[model samples]
Target: MSHRQVMKVLSGLLLGMFVAILSSTVVSTALPRIVADLGGGQSAYTWVVTASLLSMTASTPLWGKLADLAGKKVLVQSAIVIFVLASAGAGLAQSTGVLIAFRAVQGIGVGGLVALAQVILASIVPPRERGRYSGYFGATFAVATVGGPLLGGVITDTPGLGWRWCFYVGVPFAVIALAVLQRTLRLPAARRPDVRVDWLGALLVAASVCLLLVWVTLAGDSYAWASWQTAAMVGGSVLLGLLFVRVEARAADPVMPLWLFRNRTIALSALASLFVGVAMFGSTVFLSQYFQLARGESPTTAGVMTIPMIAGLFASSTVSGLVITRTGRWKAWLVAGGTLVTAGLGLLGTMRYDTAYWQLAVYMGLLGTGIGMMMQNLVLATQNQVSAEQLGAASSSVTFFRSLGGAVGVSALGAALSGRVSHYVEEGMAAAGIPQSGAAGGGAIPDLGSLPGPVRQVIESSYGHGIADVHLYAAPLALVALLLVLAVREVPLGRRAVGE
Candidate 1:
């Protein structure tokens, strides 16, 4: 395909990618409000996010493997359909349970969209020039990441439009993307008739991840961390995980091929991606809560406050990608990204509710820049090392680990945040001469507008300090990611496709 032709196909893919990201981000600012309205508490809040990540993580490898065995075009469209239906269901949900179920289903579609987009792009474009196009992905990500929150905030804040609009709003964009893809996007089919999907392997992996996440999310609040329940869940998860590995080792067509990890680049990149996911998604997902619950900002204002981070992400990804394309060098960007992310998280750890917006912005900007430089490049590095035949598995394997990290990180950190907030609120209440009974002390997300002044301050301070602690806990993980990236041997970008 010519540059123009590639661009045409890319437009549709980018739009699809936009909707997937938008689905997640758009709900971030609205979540506190959503959970409160739904009569949910902290555990519910964590599950709302964790449910999606868990499903996405579990399903990602399946989608990627299926893309290799089946045709890409139909699968992409099917994913779009699934996502749309799930979004509609989610919008109509009256309770947290129903909403969580719908969100998990939505993640199955997201897994496909996210994984297949990379596979299709790599299939169509050679690695040497892919950096330039991947930059477009970064731009689309920036736009959607920035736009979703702002859009969701406005919709949530607007009279007569409610939070449900956030879910509904993506439908039209998805429709347009589907039509555009039908018109412009074309990819050669790589269908195999004899290959069987390792359904049992996929199920085992999903079960393992689900059990571990549930355990982490519930341990401290629902039961003691060292209790029999903890032992049961942890032991169950480990057993399932072991079964998954054994099944994959013997399966004729594994959901995630075991041999891909033997490649030093893919292995190291996967490790880096896992830690990055933990550091990035785990911490940043709470920023909306920080702004709204801690700082007393309206959803709209909260969205606006996040612009600096997204802006930095946009700039770094675009510039780094362009530079990589021009010079065929990417290691420096990865290393620099690792450093910035670690620094950003550390700086963010120092924030209180009263921290200056400028300081927050600077910290956020650094983190965002680091994320931009590393995210796509990690996948790029893995993709560069694998053959065309193994492209889907290789790409998805890295993505799988990243999403796994995200799922674990969100669940674990959310639990930690809940505990920290409870502790802080209790301390604040005691210090203020208020009875513990006066506080909404069961890890419930309180409505700041309804609280008495002193109580609201305590709650705000609790969230502020709690969220900062989340970032602090995540920084060491980012540092680990940096170390992993340092160990990834840089391979020259090849002009020809792998196995060409």
Candidate 2:
């Protein structure tokens, strides 16, 4: 492809990725409203999100592998098409079950968009030049992250443009991305003949992930931590996980190459990504609820409130990426990112129902700065260490772990919040001498709009307190990541030759 064509294709990929990411993040603020209207409880709400995550996790490596064997352009275009269709289906869904199913389809497309975009970029751009462009990709992701909730909130809060619009919003963008990819993306096919995909490994991994996520979602909510249900689910997950690992070891082309675990950089990057995913997805996913329900902010205002974090992300990623490009040093940034993330969580942990919005914004900025410095750089650093032959496997491995972490984090945190909120609400009701029958049906938190002002405030406070407590859970995860990052040896940055 010509340079002009490459830029066009790059633009399309970035836009497509933006839409995919935005769909997920933007829906967060709108979810509580969506769930209440659809008549579901907290478990249903978590499933709506978890279903998408589970599908995305299962399909991500498959997409990466396909990019290597078939063609990046074809996979990316197909993904955009799927995304549009699913987005429409989700928008039209009348029941929570249908919405979750459609969202799962969207997640599959998301997996494709995310994995192939990176693979295509690697195909076209040399690694040295890659850093310069990575800043752009990171910025795109950051903007989507910031814009999603804000846009979701505005759309939800606007009469006649309710939560359903959150799903509908991405369709036009997907169409544009499709047109751009068709017109601009061109590439030589992989030199080798196609090989068989490891369907068995894929199946095993999916089953294992599903089982584990189910365990996380149910543990401590539907059952006690040590109950029979918990034991059965945990044991089943471990067994299936071990079987998946064994299958990967012997497969001709495993979805996850077991050998990549041998690379120290890849290993550490994967581990750090686990923490980053938990901290990033686990925390950010809940913030819209915190702001809108807990802090009495309108959806639009809540979206606007998140800008500090986005700004921090944009500033830190662009600046750090450029500096690394110039100085050929990345480890310091990694250390800094981990430190900032840990500190951000520590600050957020101190939040209460009465905490100031500006204070929350400051903590958020620190969090975004930490994430911007870490997320993409970890993948870039891993790519730097591996040979080109292993690039797809290596890169996908990092993403796979990240997705796994996200799945685990979202499920675990959702379960934790459900438990905490239920406990707190019960305590508040008892203290207020309110009868359980007077509250809304189901022990789940009430809709902010339906409750009496005092009841709403109590519920909101419970959520704020619950959200703040989760950060303590997140903080240590980040600190552990920081220590792991310290052991990663720095590599000099430069333009990578093809197949280096």
- Measured by lDDT, the strongest candidate is 1
lDDT of 1 by residue, 89-196 (tens): 999999999999999999999999989999999998889888888888998999999998999999999999999989998999999989999998877779899899
**TM-score winner:** 1
Q: Clashes per prediction?
A: 0, 1
Range of the 10 consecutive residues with the lowest summed lDDT in candidate 1: 434-443
Q: All predictions: root-mean-square deviation over Cα?
A: 1.0, 1.8
Error of 2 at 26 (Å): 2.5
Stretches of candidate 1 off by over 4 Å are none
